[model samples]
Target: MRQNAERCTAALSAAVSNYVDIFEHVEGQIIHAHQKDQERKRNCVMMPSKKLQTFLSLPKKQMKKSLSETSELEKELGNYTCALHARLSPNEHTAIKNSDYVKLSESIGTSVKQAKKIATTVKLIRNVQKQVKKPEINPSKEFTMAALF
Candidate 1:
């Protein structure tokens, strides 16, 4: 499990850092192009896109919000993991530590008893869904005297 977690953590870290680096590189190129175009066109050029401007001019609150959102997204993405120990990226680890899962579970009324009931109920529902009727060994073809009365 530890090995799996380490492997997964390394992979996620590499992927996320790679993605962010690529985006920053692209953003830098856009800014550079805008600057060169402005100098070349001399007041006849389109301004940098709103996205670029927003990326460049993120306020403190927005920066914090974006970081929190990224962490949350990464945490949720953890659920899609099918292999190995739960390798958590740094952000996801932080998010999980910060989240009050116990409180949330309590608020949602998800106790051990409720969970047990739900599990049994789900099993029963699946049995009903199978729709397999058992064959009757003895056929009661004749009408009973009680029915004749």
Candidate 2:
């Protein structure tokens, strides 16, 4: 009877120790993940203007080009508005007011631009997917995928 009790006590002690070890391992993983996340967040602050300028250091011609594209798009959009207004109705004394016509033209332009943006974003994602290198798995080494947990 004493031997049986001793064995039972030993088993119980081993089980408790295993549980404590697993709990500690999981706790350590959680702490590690949290610390890594906090470190990433700390490193993401915006750089100062001087530092940013030094980092960029773009050529003057390239900078001029970037600025010009903005004004050019604005002018092109204005031309679209002018063409739309001309086709739709006269400037003054029309059944539809000029403000309403301008608003309608602006909304149409915005929708067209949004559609283009969605298309461009999709294209970019597809391009990135194409560029990504997939690990080569030998067909002979392939096994049935594991069932969902």
Best by lDDT: 2
Compute each candidate's TM-score over C-alphas. 0.26, 0.32
> Whose TM-score is greatest here?
2
lDDT tens per residue, model 1, 1-149? 99999889988999999999999999999999777645543422122245423532555445445545676432322232211012222332233344544443343346645534433333332232232223323434334544666
Backbone Cα, N, C clashes tallied per candidate: 0, 0
> Model 2: per-residue lDDT, tens digit, 1-149?
99999989989999999999999999999999778655543442222235223322445444344435566533443343343333332322131332343443343333544434423333332333233224446665565343322
Off by over 4 Å in 1: 1-3, 43-149
lDDT of 1: 0.44
Q: Among all windows of ten consecutive residues in candidate 2, which has the lowest summed lDDT?
A: 89-98
How many steric clashes does model 2 contain?
Answer: 0
